[model samples]
Target: MTATATAAVIAPAPEAAPALRDTRPLRLITCGSVDDGKSTLIGRLLWDTKAVKEDQAAALNRDSGKQNDLGLPDFALLLDGLQAEREQGITIDVAYRYFATDKRSFIVADTPGHEQYTRNMATGASTADLAVLLVDARAGILEQTRRHATIATLMGIKQFVLAINKIDLINYDKARFDELSLEFKEIALSLGVKQVTAIPVSALKGENVVYDGKASMPWYEGPTLVEVLELATVRSAQTVGFRLPVQRVSRPGESFRGYQGTVAGGAVKPGDSVVILPSGMVANVKQIVTFDLVRNAAVAGDAITLVLDRQVDVARGDMIATIDAQPQVGLAFDAQLVALQPGGIEPGKRYWLKSGSRRQRVSVQPSSLLDLKSGKWNRHDGALPMNAIGKVHLSFDEAAIFDAYELNRTTGAFILIDPDTNNTVAGGMISAKRGDLGGLNNEAERVILSLPADLADKILASGILSERRDEIDIRRTNPGRAAELLGELDS
Candidate 1:
């Protein structure tokens, strides 16, 4: 009997799906180990879905020297566009491809799987709503698979589709597929991933991609790759208030002054009360301007110009947000970042942190590095090495404004730019404000606990602590500090 292990994954039957669906294009990424067939899987999707044209198909047939076991031309050639990549038979960079079905449209990023190219994977995963992680059936899972999954999860990709590719190589064995699914579920659970779906596929032969593979494996009954993507939702539902990070101030004439930028979160309308961050100036939306016409209302992802009713000292790098539901304004914040450059992140070094459209000088201090093998964040001091994922404390020269990445990815994610070279060195996600206790007064008391990260995570996850989670603040600390705190409590 096939185990109901993937039930937690929200994959409904096609006939049972909702008629009214979200029309937004679903952004996803295909990632796993090298030779796991990431590019081939995408090419197969394009070929089967009719996204490939006649001329391109002819070129694929003409240039392709190697063919798979099914007597099919190398589908991976479609994505590996560079001449060198074709000769090397390797993916060198992240390739963004667009394809649409009658039901929905998609934007998929096919990321490189090499460990050295992990930074490229981070770039692709940052904006992706879902991750289609591929795995070789014979190989099960590799370290690179864990690396990609960890980075994707950290970058807030909640939905995952584990494509067990090359199932025909293992004789389409149902037992092997089941075993990989179970193993993946365990790893996903450990990484705090709740939504996951596993499918057995053979990209070389195009089984279980866009069409059903009932003839190949009659025992499995599930949706295909296209079906899952059509229904996959973006990760911006849990949003609060309105956010407009001013990219530029437009003043065509002396009479006209408009703040131009994309709406990062929530919605804005005329006469809506908005506050400018870093300066704390209040204003009201007088007119919403666009290139074509004035918009009555603008929601997240909309790019529009805004005219405030009153004169405010607004400039580039300033944030315009709702008054009541404003983002955190502070000088210190905790964040997790992946070092992208070879020089790594040097502690106590000032770098330009760019979030949304705002860029400001900030100093970073590395505190802990995540060990992918152990699945633990170990205490560390000093510079973060290249491609290393580490937790750091950011100190800005002036007030910095941001929401927690979990709450608003647009306002919460940022990149660190090296001051001397002007090159981006790291990508980061803001975890929380340094010393924020929301809506708490002096009369109201709160409990603060310093515990080992593992124990603290367990307690925070427990139902008992979860009910009053707001009343308590638990901070994970190094073992020495945790022990010292325990001793002080006993004394």
Candidate 2:
């Protein structure tokens, strides 16, 4: 299937995740440095939750036979199923696991735990509702730990659970656990993480992972890993705004095709008035549809097709949402971009901006570079280098509606892809607009008079009537006089 076709079938969850108590399953992304037992911890969680199948459990029991240690289950094998992964005993690819308890269903993306593979971890964690960060108790807080925390924060993961694994190696000592917990707590808090719960676990022995065997440290007063995950409440966890980027316009068998997507937030009901973004085309939501189910109102996380009251020339890359909460439209907005590789982002290089299922052509104009180590935004360094996060002013080929990452992630978060290679070069979040920094007069007169007539029409239609009228007058007047008039208007 085409990229657009695949994106249409697979719904992308928007910014705010649903509540912990909601009907939707909790989706989490697990990230850690190498050998931190991210897979083992997750495997044990599944095992204890009774989500593991009998065949898988039997296979794990058989393959884990060591030369001296026999009959022990290789829990890691449950997730690291690839032959290369078993030979090396290190995760090299992302493995997705689905399991659920009586309380919540989960979709866990188990990412590689290597420093060099940090970019992959970022990709998985970007859409996570909560981040399960594993730290080796023996290693304490390493550089990679800080790196993962930084990426998690940058990716907008608000709730964090710091699972300090391999505690058995430290003899399950309270002093060691307390010391490490305090240190990691300070780091997590500094990263602006909303929640941090430190749990000591021997993923190898299943201590504190599932039931916290009596042989493990009894002095520990904290809940088991399973309890914390099942009981922890994340209030205001995610914004539930309505964001459905039209991934595809499909007409099956007859002329009955419709727009399809996974609802990111809010509810969509039949007869709800909606507007398609960028185009501003309005249509009534004719039906809340899915291949298997049709309903009056569909809430957050429902992957379904939408039948509009009228065929309003909708297409892929367009977004349809209720008229009440319209997305903010603009071509220029500030975004925080994090580079994954060594190459820097060239100021004038064109890239594809991927938000939800929508993609737009955009140019990266340098603004300020953020130094991750020092925690400061600096003047232009020509371009953003690898493993670096910076803020840039993006100029899109067309205006797109978006929300501030702080307000709604579905609309605020976006990915920058190389137009030539189609490789995702940068991950970004909309912070604010540069124009929002100054007075309204300066923003009004900042446009060029020579823009195409269609663009001029859009600027006029954007409801900034004064700017439109001023632009029209400038175009009709002499160039030198127009400059002077604009200067006066700004002043």
Assess every candidate by TM-score: 0.84, 0.77
Give RMSD to native, each candidate.
Answer: 12.2, 11.9
Best by TM-score: 1
Model 1's C-alpha root-mean-square deviation from the true structure amounts to 12.2
Worst 10 residues of 2 by lDDT: 470-479
What are the per-residue Cα lDDT tens digits for candidate 2 across 1-491? 69989877565443233443445656687787789889988887788778889998888778878722434577788889889999999887788888876666778888898876767888887777788889888887777777778878877777788888888888887898889889877777777775888888888778887787557788888888777767654423236446687888878767686888877666778877677776766677788778788888886677889998887988887887656565566667878877776575878888888888887888888778755455556898487787666778877777766777776767788888887777778888887654545332246423434323354455456565563565442122234554564455446
lDDT of 1 by residue, 137-223 (tens): 999899889888988988998999999999988889999999999998889999999899999998878899998899999988998
Clashing pairs in 1: none
Model 1 weakest lDDT span, ten residues long: 436-445
Compare the candidates by lDDT and give the number of the best one: 1
Candidate 1 segments whose C-alpha is farther than 4 A from its true place = 1-22, 436-491
